[model samples]
Target chain A: MIEVENIEDQNGLRPDGRRALELRQIRVKMGVFGQADGSAYIEQGNTKILVTVYGPHQPRGSTGRSTSNITKGIVNCQYSMAVFSLSSGERKRKPRGDRKSQERSLQLKHAMEAIIHLEIYPRSQIDIYVEALQVDGSEYCASVNAATLALIDAGIPIKNYAIGCTVTLINNPSLEDEDNALGKGVLDANYVEECTPGVTLSVVALPNNDSTSKDGLIVVAQGAGQRLHLSQFESLKARVLYGCQDIRTILDYAVREYLTEQSLPSLFHVALN
Target chain B: MEEYPPIIVRLAINRIDLNLIKNENVQPRIYTPGEEISSQPDFLRGHGTYVDDENTLRASVAGVLEKVNKLISIRPLKARYQGEIGDVIVGRITEVQQKRWKVDTNSKLDSVLLLSSVNLPGGELRRRSAEDEQTMRRYLQEGDLICAEVQSTFVDGSLSLHTRVLKYGKLSQGIMLKVSPALIKRKKTHFHNLESGASLILGNNGYIWIGANKQDSDRSEGGFTQDLSRIPQINREVCARLRNCILILAQCNIQLTDTSVTYAYEESMKYKINELLEPEIMIDVSLLTHQRLIQQ
Candidate 1:
């Protein structure tokens, strides 16, 4: 077993050599597939995800047609982990169609629902398919980030970026004894740290236009591992919010870069004219 | 003996240099979702814009903005095909219903192709009969590709397609490649038979078809008869080459039209059909094609 003490060395560097607050390098590409209405590929740290957005078209089949809302658009999400995503030596029989996959799919829909402007595409259904090619840690967070880019690629109207981030509470409570309440909480926790006995909080938030908006509207929050104290929740949530903000800024830059590439020669034409 | 060489792979970066674009005085304005557009009183909200609580017009998608009189709209970089009357499209039949066939045109909804709109197999003015209704699948069965024009659009944004013209009917023995709908240039006609032996149909919905040049197609039968006869090796080679050329051009985000495609095909003649898929060759051919377009 990889112990938390072993993962976090005496120098305060995690096994990945990233500081507690530091994020993994992010790389994103939009419109990775021509067939999908909108598609994106994103890599954060060692985790990689590909997301494709289809529809806002008429719902498919009788079930899709029957379940679609008349006044608001339906956001359907499927989160599937690839067979090789497991870091364990043993392989799983099924990549999806399991209880855990279903739960993750539902959680993804909730995160998407909070961001998408559902009322604008009334009677239509938008399907978001996320495939996790590799899972290091924060797979859920990476899925949210990749889906946001895919929605942007598809030109679907979104209210704001639904950025997700995970924070793990360090076992070293003595750092909290020094007066810095959040000293022991690590931002953007990885797979090994996530597996540690400490509490982990995964939050999906929409950062407000106001940069100082500390606790932006939380869309989804899932806590796992050891039981967290009520007093620790505030500090852990704040750390996650900060992580979310950093991610949103990176994703926003990516979206702008993609848009610039898309409108290129038109800019040239305008300049020449 | 080996007929074709194995494929080679190389890594290349596809980054757009914004600094180079910045040298130009006119940098195209781009909008992302939730970005404020305007608060002016006279401007009306358009398809890609909505008024927020403070009466500020905000963009809903990322793209360039267009203004005409009081209407302000942001056109997304890419979206499902939004149909307009008289627009040409190529689609595959998904389902054959009672009086219509559901055609997937890469649109927001499956477009409808009514039996009444298409020319009957025997003649143009044939009356509807029980036999024709029962044999609807035979006329244009599921998975059959067809070229048609947009007759109308429903309020929900679905399209009604018609194949009344001789050129608009079943397509056979062709390769179809889909690209972003925004890349297709709106032209007077979508069908073209290049000086090269391949005939091309650049669907407005971005479904392009390239096929062997079929002269003297049976028009009296209304394109229902299949020409399953084996095309010569040379014609097949020409069709494959044209397909590769079109794919490369589309990949580079070039506007697809008859002139542009012809230029790309001509520029790509120096390389084998498979060689054109290489990153360096694709860029070289498209760059030459781009230069020729500008010169024209």
Candidate 2:
């Protein structure tokens, strides 16, 4: 693992030399398939994810818990992976639903609910299955973007964005003299950065869609780490906010590009294949 | 008829990067005397598109619609059909029965390619004297590529084929891969062997067989070379690797087949310049895209 022992005062850049809140490149595409009502493939830096939206139709073979809501639509999510869709040298044989996938599914559902209109069509189900073809980092963020495009492809309406971002606390308090704010404010933690034992937080922010709505709701913010103070938390939140705004711009452009059928669609690493 | 001005919907590219550009690529098709384009279209039209109600023209709203006579109908997994006795179709091997294999030809049930239906190398038309059976296995195995003629369609759409001809026999050289039956039957299927160091065979049944020599590479000799420098001693493993490479190309959905694999180049052809093979831009026709629910 690569280690960054010291924080920098020069421009406050992280180890990657990125600004306090600089996100990786985001490439997206909508309606990339023939079968799905709406489908999207997104690549945030090296991480590639494909999302497909299926049905507000009746449930298929009652197995999972079904919502009693009669008028709103129910969203069914299955976050799986292709046999070889992992960064590890050896491919993952199992589909999603391992401890990691299950956790992701829940977090994904939490983030998704923030945007998808579950109240529109009652007694119906919307299935969003995301395949993480490659994981570099920010899987949750990638899934959120993919799901949004899939939803839009499915023509689903949503209230603001249900955007997600991963913020890694560069300040690994565990290492003495590891530079105060070593993991300081950074946006869009890639796989290399996320693996370090620093505190990592996944924040699903309902951004200031109206600009003035700065009193935004942090829908699903969960972090895992050692004892951490509140100031670090505040800075992290701010970084996550910046990341969300950045992602929203990419996604908004993607949706618009899809509608206008833009020639020379914006590039993506996953869909071009 | 000069009665009505035709409506053409064509889409143009503003930015080749977006891949939102649509082209009016057309090819010619063969039509049965009375077979009209099925009145029902079980597919979605991209923006600026419409399938006429009368099953005639699937016109483009803004781009050009090239008319080809060949119209393909999607068949259910089990629906079987008798081959037209001469029509070249793609299929997959479903079962290898005694001296025969049941091939799924994108129809109900499967089609049969009997051992006797294939031609023996060295041009002999004799019945299988036990030695022939051993030789046939060496030439055409359980999952080998042999272009056979549909001899007949039996009780349940089971088709019998015959390939005792010069054009049909064991395939050698080159490589092959398996994909969704939908891809094989795509109207503009690429089969012309392009840039071939070998030859390939695409069995309507799922088996893809390839050979090394131009004879092994099948008919698209131009794709291969005459500048052999010398008769390069082709090994069996190299032949297999070439097959694997072609398979990878298919998995990538690059579409290189024994029939439609022609390399096209044009001054305006942006295929190379645009980095078109990137996975992000290619629209894989998936089962999920049909979800019409606009998320609210």
Candidate 3:
């Protein structure tokens, strides 16, 4: 096992050559599947996720959970990883129906329920299914980002962009002379950095466009690995929030480009004037 | 020995460019979810806009902004069909209840086809007896397709469909294709008998049907009788060609109307029927059809 001290080099560069605040490269594609109502594929570094959204339609009775609510709609999510998704060169035994996948599915459902406007849909239900083709690190965050794009592709009404980002707090022994706030936290963590002895905080946030609030609303936050001091929590959250904002900008641009390419040419005659 | 077939492998970056055919001068205003459409309180909120905590109107879906007088709505590029009264639809019977049949019309909610709304086989004014309610499956069983019109809507947005007309009833021996509802343009007539000897029904719900043209004698038989006799090969070819043509038009995001479909079918004649499935051929055919439509 590698020590936490070697995660970052002496010149202030992470193992992947990214700075402390820099994120990995993100690529998004909307409406990748024709049969699904909405679908999106997102690649964040080496982690690849595909999310498909179906419904705003009548609820089904097959799941046996009693989804027949009369007042508002429900969001159902299923998270699964492929058998060959493990980055350590070994195949997973099961694709889904495991304890870890079920927990991630529930967390994804809660994050989706916060952004979706359920009242308008009434007795209908929306189903989102996430499939992880490759898992390096931060799989839940990639799934959340892909699910947001899929919901937008499906044209389901929602409050705002639900951006997910992971932050890691690495205790640096060599940077004692520098300021504590500058080099203590990293924006996104990969498999190597995640294995180190540090706290990895995964956050799903709704980045609002309102002028009053600078910090966006955090919908779901989960901390894993080592515990952190109470004083370091605020700065860790702030770093994750900043990372979420940057992701939102990239996703927003992709959506606009998709719309421009898919919009009918004839409708533009009536819209431009 | 038989020759092997050719396979095309292209990179994602080399996919056909859709913007090459679009008009450069027309750039529409696009909106995403939670983007503010209007800060004022006076604008009437439509289907895709909601009031925030600050009382300002924000778009709920991502699409182009549509403004009509004081009403503001964001129309998504593609979504499930929202039924309107008097619109034609093609649906499949999913279940048979006591007095109503549930029809899946590609809408948010399953539409209902009440027994009272359909015309009985005996006559137009015949009463619906208790035996008629029990034999509802005999008229339209599960998994059967039908053509109907939207009669009204319930408080929960489910549509009530009617098949009282002589033209709307159980459809038999046809090819059905589903496309995005946004690609279908609303026109005066949804049914068209093309010059190529094929009949087409462009359902507002995005379910398109292509079949042999029905004779005048078939209409007087209450539409329950089926013509099981084999259709001629020429008619089958025309139907297959028509189906491929409509798929091409939909893939290119061109509106599906009778005129545009006919133009596509005509332009696709240069290539054989199976050859139309090629990526380059599909793009070429749709481009020709688009150019012809602009000239009109």
Best candidate (score: DockQ)? 3
lDDT of 2 by residue, A104-137 (tens): 7877776666565565445556788999888887
Give the TM-scores of the predictions, in the order they appear. 0.89, 0.46, 0.95
DockQ of each: 0.43, 0.02, 0.68
Clashing pairs in 3: none
Candidate 1 vs 3: which has more lDDT: 3
Better model by TM-score: candidate 1 vs candidate 2: 1
The backbone clash count of each candidate, in order, is 0, 95, 0
Q: Name the docking class for model 2.
A: incorrect
**Cand. 2 Cα-lDDT:** 0.53
**Candidate 3's residue-wise lDDT over A97-164, tens digit each?**
89989989999998889889888777788999999999988889999999999999998888888889
Best by TM-score: 3
All candidates: interface RMSD: 3.4, 16.4, 1.6
Model 1 stretches with alpha carbons more than 4 Å out: A4-20, A56-72, A87-90, A120-124, A171-178, A181-184, A211-216, A219-225, A229-232, A264-273, B11-26, B40-42, B122-126, B214-218
Q: Best candidate per lDDT, number?
A: 3
What would the per-residue lDDT of candidate 2 be over residues B84-189, giving only the tens digit for each residue?
Answer: 5454554445445567766545333356777777654444555666675545445444554445556876653347876655555444333445443323432342
Q: What are the lDDT figures for the candidates, one per model?
A: 0.80, 0.53, 0.84
Candidate 2 regions with alpha-carbon error over 4 angstroms: A3-12, A63-67, A173-183, A212-223, A262-273, B1-296
Q: With candidate 3 superimposed using the best TM-score fit, by how many Å does residue B230's alpha carbon deviate from the native?
A: 0.7
